[model samples]
Target: MLLEALTHTWPWYIAGPLIGLFVPLLQLVGDKQLGISGNLRHLCSALLPRRIDFLRYDWRGAGAWNLIFALGTLLGGWIGVHLLGTGEIAISPDTQASLHALGVHDLSGLVPHEIISWEGLLTVRGFVSVVAGGFLVGFGTAYAGGCTSGHAISGLSNFQLRSLFAVLGFFAGGLLATHLLLPLLF
Candidate 1:
């Protein structure tokens, strides 16, 4: 029963409140901003040893725990897939219908192999969605000063106006992608 629970999804009502609690917990424990994207800077600082202004900080002092968090995320994902995964994945009927309408036939994998594989990557649809979309995500995250998780969770918790604007922009972009760009590509 425990293993079954581990392999299954959590109800949003339960999961959402737990995730929401993280912000206050983090604030109480340490006055640190919770964001995954900022860890990249700390990593670059350690590896490059450059004299760049942004990279000049004592990354270990400030972001050692963040790096550990990143490591744990990676490890947890591996453990989940290898030790706890049930091989079958669950998707909503509406999502499956939408994908079908978009010409996706395979629903066996986490992502449609027809659109995400090496061969599929050379196709225009795959190239645009995977490569170009990835670039846009990275660029947008930097331009906004943080990722969606940061803005929606930590920044909002601290009542930052910039984060509110960033979250709105994120919603707009996602709406645009889902309603327009995604249909055009797929």
Candidate 2:
């Protein structure tokens, strides 16, 4: 039963609450912020010379737990994939039809290889979808002061108004991307 549960996706009702509860548990344990975007800054600060103002910080004191958390997340993903394995993503038939119409036939993996593979990267559609999309996400994360997980989970749990606005913006951006931008790209 435990193996079955570990290998399959949990329903939102089960997964959502677990993720929601993680915020307080994280705070209760160490008062650490729940975010992944800051890990890049922490890593750069640790590796790079302390000449740049942004990279010059006590990253060990501020983000050691975050780094450890990131490492644990990576390890967990490896274990889940290599040892436990994963069930196929259950995309709805209607959604699959829509994607098929957009020229994405293969729904075998976590993402569509048509849009994410090396050959795809060299094409205009792939370059715009992957490279440009990644740049926008990174820029938006930096601008919003946190990623969706941080703002939606940790920041909102803490009753931060900024996080509320950030989450709203994130949703709006996602909607725009899905409806308007995705069709154009695909």
Best by TM-score: 2
Instruction: Looking at model 2, report the run of 10 residues with the lowest lDDT sum.
Output: 48-57
Clashes of each: 0, 0
Q: Score each candidate by Cα lDDT.
A: 0.83, 0.85
Tens-digit lDDT track of model 2 for 76-180: 889977887867899899999988888888898777787888888988878888899888987788678799678988889889999999999999999999889
Q: Model 2: which residue pairs collide?
A: none
Q: TM-score of predicted model 2?
A: 0.89
Residue lDDT tens for model 1, 39-138: 7778878888577877788999988988998898899778877787747667889989998998888988667888888888999988887899878876
In model 1, where do residues sit more than 4 Å from their true spots? 45-56
Highest lDDT: give the candidate number.
Answer: 2
